[model samples]
Target: MIYLQLFLSFFQVGLFSFGGGYAAVPLIQNQIVETHHWLELSQFADLVTIAEMTPGPIAINSATFVGQQVAGLPGAILCTLGCILPSFILVLMLSCLYMKYRSMKAMQGILAGLRPAIVAMIAGAGMSILLLALFQGALSHIRLGNFRVVECMLFLVSLFLLRRYRISPIAVIFGSGIVGTLIYTLLPV
Candidate 1:
């Protein structure tokens, strides 16, 4: 029953998530954090941190992590499948339709309309994560001084390096993890 729940929850997220992995975060949070109460808000933050630090899409990572946390390896496999199934089926069907409608003006217009909606969904997901982080960091009893500043610096540095220098993501994750460990050791907690 727990495995079924994990699969269904992620299946719903996969079905409605239109703008890629980040766009699925809020929906997953709503399901796992709010609806099921399987994880606390702080745990959700940790999930996001772990997801980002690992390889793969954020949505898949979240599904696998949450499922494993809730149940075990079986839950992880089911949730991962649920997360990807919609995209697999939708893309296959759409590819066929796209090939058939290659010269159709109406189809082209529909595709154009979808672009902005997808962008909006992605933006909403990002904002949701940011709001959660800010709210938690501000309201927590053990708030760290200048934590937001550190977050902003890391975000900016990451964006700059990825966009400008095209650093490999694996390199960034491993490098940052080492740097973060060193910083934690050096800085006063």
Candidate 2:
């Protein structure tokens, strides 16, 4: 029964979440934090961090983490499969139709309209992460004022390294974790 519930919950999430992984953040927040109580807001924030830093889509990582937390490895597997089914089915169905219609002016216009929506979703996800990170004091949560300065610096540095140096994301993740751990231990909040 628990497994079934986990599968169904994630399936619903999968069915409706659009605009890819970042877009799913608000929905997951509602489902897991507000409706289901599977995790607290803080935990959801941590999950987002883990999801972002890990490989694969953010939504899948979230589902797997939540499922594992709720009911272990089997639950994680079921939830991941359930969450992915809608995308798999829809893409398979749409591939034929899309191939036919992709070049149509009206379809192109519709897709153009979707670009802003996707941007908004990505922005929302970024905001969620920023809030969570600040709240946890992980990303320069302390300052007499202008605490965001630290966050901005880190963000710029990360962006520069990623864009210019083409550093692998996995390397960044591991480096950040080690650095954050050391910071947490050495510094007193």
Candidate 3:
């Protein structure tokens, strides 16, 4: 029963989630945090961080992680399948239609309309995670004073590196992790 719930939950996420994994963040959060109460917001944010650091799409990684957290291996498999199934079917259908209507103005207009919505969704997800990281325990306790200076610095530096220097995201992630570890170890709590 729980497995079915998990499958259906992720299936819904996969079905309605347009654009890419970043766009799916809100849907994942709504299902895992608000609707199902399977994971707290902070945990979901952490999961997003981990998912971003790891290979593969954020949506798939999140479904697998949440499923494993809830019901172990089988849950992970089922949830992953559920999350992937809808996207797979949709993409197959869309690919055929897109090829047929590649030059259609209506199709181009639809894609153009989706572009901004996808950007907004991604931006919203980034802000949510930023809030979670900066205001430590904000999700669980609603505390706004517990600002993490080191994290903020890391975020700024990472942003600077990525934007100003055009460093690869993989390098930025690893560098930030190393810097964070050093800070935790060398700096007094």
User: Pick by lDDT: which candidate is best?
Assistant: 3
Q: Comparing candidate 2 with candidate 3, which one achieves the higher lDDT?
A: 3
Clashing pairs in 2: none
lDDT string for model 2 (111-165, tens) is 8998998899889878767765644443335444534444454566676888999
Candidate 1 lDDT, tens digit per residue, 77-104? 9999999999999999999999999899
Instruction: Give the residue spans of candidate 2 off by over 4 A.
Output: 136-168
TM-score per prediction, in order, is 0.81, 0.81, 0.92
Off by over 4 Å in 3: 139-144
> Which predicted model would earn the best TM-score?
3
User: Which is superior by lDDT, 1 or 2?
Assistant: 1
- The whole-model C-alpha lDDT of candidate 2 against the native structure comes to 0.81
lDDT at 114 for candidate 1?
A: 90
- What is the Å distance of residue 111 in model 3 from its true position? 1.4
The C-alpha stretches of model 1 lying farther than 4 A from their native spots are 131-147, 163-169
